[model samples]
Target: MAKKKATAKAADNLTFLKTPTGINGLDEITLGGFPKGRPTLICGAAGCGKTLFSLEFLVKGVEEFNEPGVFIAFEEKADELALNVTSLGFDLKKLQDEKKLRIDYIHIDKSEIEETGEYDLQGLFIRLGYAIDSIGAKRVVLDTIENLFSGLTNEGILRAELRRLFQFLKDKGVTAIITGESGEKTLTRQGLEEYVSDCVILLDHRVVNQISTRRLRIIKYRGSLHGTNEYPFLIDEDGISVLPVTSLKLDKPVSAEIINSGIPSLDKMFPTGGFYKGSSILTSGTAGTGKTSIAVSFADAACKRGEKCLYFAFEESPAQIIRNMKSIDLNLQKHVDKGLLKFYASRPTMYGLEMHLVAIHKAIQKFKPNVVVLDPITNLITIGSFSEVKSMLVRMIDFLQENQITVMFTALTLSTVINDQTDDGVSSLVDSWLCIKDIEMNGERNRGLYVMKARGMQHSNQIREFVITNKGLSLVDVYLGPDGILTGSARETQMLMEETGQVLHRNALGRKDREVLRKRKLLEAKIESLKTEFESAEEELNKIYIEDEIKRGVLNKTRQQMTDLRSGNKDI
Candidate 1:
């Protein structure tokens, strides 16, 4: 099954022969890379990274692909070019010394060009060809092609030279990149140059809200499919990195496994015990509702399980986050020291949303983390509009889920109205939405946590008390008072009142039982006494009857004496 997916993954590159531009994320955008043995045009405004993009392509080719490259500069000197790239860790001096690279700075004097009365590339082609042959280079770059059109008055001659320059690179069988200044109406200053190139890329530098961002778009690629969307690229110490959009198919392999929410009670809320692997989770709440606590718990859990976690903090510094988490007994610094957790903190206004997304994409690709946390994504809305933030989040979630990495991001709900609705910021894009809201009553604000939705699992509908103690984060069952589900101090107060009422009820029941026993004992004593008195009276009555019987017998005996005298003759 995996083999089939792998084959399908490579199907996009099967249509053509290409040379890989080893810049991060560029190969995926081009599906294979630039077209082989063809000149590609990169046109952008000044300081838009057109030159760095080409230099990175050449340097990466030489270092990674073992392809020697020649860079022919027309705007800067060879030493200046080499010095400017040293910050990117490109050892140009060493590469040139090893004969693996060549840099030729062709001085283009506009005055000399006007005096010469011609715009031609034969002499320049000879030098470029000699440099390529000297190092057996397979890659070439012509930085700032606008210099060739500096003083040209005849459009036909400039057009012819542009065709010859591209044809020369193609004839030499080397994949070439030519950088040019963006024209007001066309892709390059020389409007006809883009027509002759096999591929044309446009770099854009846009500033929104005083924050600058760099974007790259592929205008056209002949005979090979390429992404036409504007991809965000970042230039750090390593060099240019373009964050390519995914294949845009929902064909990523799914996992049946479930991972915990790092809080045991929160995991118990779901029937599967936690979130599904690679699921996107959104934890949203008002201020001080423990949203960051949830993120910290997840990072701590991932690190505890020996899995890497990347935490992107847009508000606090790394040390501040670490110290804040420590109050909850979560030692994040230990995870940092162990290299299992990484924190990337940047202000939301540091750059446009696209560049932040690029940084996130680059960081995830480099760290290969098992999970990621974007603490409070609502801060991103300050830099971009709501739709732009949502769009950026859509792309970010797509990238994360495609990698099968679990992501738990927090969103702040600033609305004062308490309702059943979750903060709808990116809520539609997540697989699970954990809505935490403030239940303010009894002069205190308490957190009530409930699962708004958890896809593919049975989850609890009842809200729980989202507790954050010094030991850690936990969820306890909220109280059901007369008013309804009670939380925080009100819930505790209700519990105490009910406990006191139960104690009083038990004591009353015990006292009533004792009194009933005492009354029953008194009644039994009275019955015993009455029985003794009745027995004594019956004995006295019997004795009187015996005495009366004796008296009657004596009287009868007197009478019987006379009668007996008569009867005695027969029976004395």
Candidate 2:
């Protein structure tokens, strides 16, 4: 046994290697690319971008990886294939001239090809071998293997030939990508090629609410870790870009600096200066509760700080958003002109939920914004289930936080539902929650803002009155007097009534004091007049006494004086 173990086999056994697909996100989803030295089947319905994906994979291998590739098209001509990918900036003819790519358009006539007994597709193999050998292709793409079945109707011969083709490709040690139209129940039209191949990818093009979205899912990739989610893919000028739905677990430290929430008074409520950088702030309220306005104001604040911000408006167009923000006194056009703000407006049902996420992700990547605003995330619920939307938000928040980008999401809550549990299904994932409510008091609606929670920071628990004016968003001090939270038109009425009441009380007190003073002055004048009369009478009596005394001295000095005069006359 030891002697037998001493003998080692040659190390020439084929090992698993990934070939680059040249697509943006496809390599990440496939864990590098498809299995090297093996065939991969890509199946989907018509107009699902199967042919484009195949061509991108081959061209990417040739141009990027420096690996020669062979594109064997069964349906399309060479000129048509070349013209189609020109928009993607891929020049197939140039690659062929450089001896890096070999594109062979196999024109098969179904009526002419005779399927005899015990026949194999040796001619097809010979053609593929010639093309691969001509350029020494390390990567091969066979688009629409089903076209072979269409030309040859014999099932046994077709299956045998397909198995032989797979074996032939494997022996050649070339990584091949095979594309086919999707079948109703199987992975591919024939189903045999999918099983024979080492990898399988399914492409889907669906129109939900009139907006078409293309999605890619890896059904199976043998011996490789691949994403299973339906990734959103876009066919643009650069070629097909797939957005992987999974996230990596890299521990990136986030900033703790407090960033403003647009409204200064609102920012003052937070004890940590403001919300933490990379935090998720949720503003939820009933319709017309200024949810979108708050979100826009936050974006404006970020723009003022010279930080790039992105505004994703699902319910309003960019022009309409600008118009509405102007009414609130937030001039977003200035920020747009300064290159600080970017607005992306689309319908929630414009595509599927995944497509929306991809669009946002791509925009964020392209803009590298510091702040991201999603006005009324509830609109996303229109296209997806509650759990689906929640899941998407969780992923999105995680992505933003990982990138250290602050996020503000607004949600429109319905008044018919009472309770926090009935929120728009995204409140639990937020770092800060601001609930705006329309309180009906004194027969008028008032806007009240309250901080439900601010994680890792102390915040005021009191409900603050908020107003949206032409200047911007402001938090009026809480009305602590008789009236609570004076807002809307009622604030004016309350203020007017308060002023009138104070004026009336002052006028009534002034009148009472004036009346009391008038009566006191009348009494004082009467007493003084009486005293003057008494004094005058006393003086007159004194004068009369003097005159009588003089007359009584004349007449008793007038009586007493008259008595004295009488006594003096008697003495005389």
Winning candidate number (TM-score):
1
The TM-scores of all predictions, comma-separated, are 0.88, 0.81
Q: Compared with the true structure, what per-residue lDDT tens digits does model 1 show for residues 522-553?
A: 88888888788877777788779888899889
**lDDT for model 2, on a 0 to 1 scale?**
0.85
Local accuracy by lDDT, each model:
0.87, 0.85
> Given candidate 1, what's the lDDT at residue 502?
97
How many Å off is the CA of 310 in candidate 2?
Answer: 1.3
Backbone clashes in model 1, listed as residue pairs:
none
lDDT of 2 by residue, 1-572 (tens): 33532331122244457777878889889888888778988889999999999999888888789989999999999999999999989999999999999889998898777666777778899999999898888899888878987887888787877888899998887888888887778777788544455788889998766667899998888887888988889887878889886686757576779899889899989877689999999998888989999999899999999999999999999999899899978899999999999999988987888788878888898899999999879998888878878878877988898889999999887663546764656667788999887777777777889898898899999888888777788887656657455666677777788899999999999999999999999999999999999999999999999987776665543456556666776653
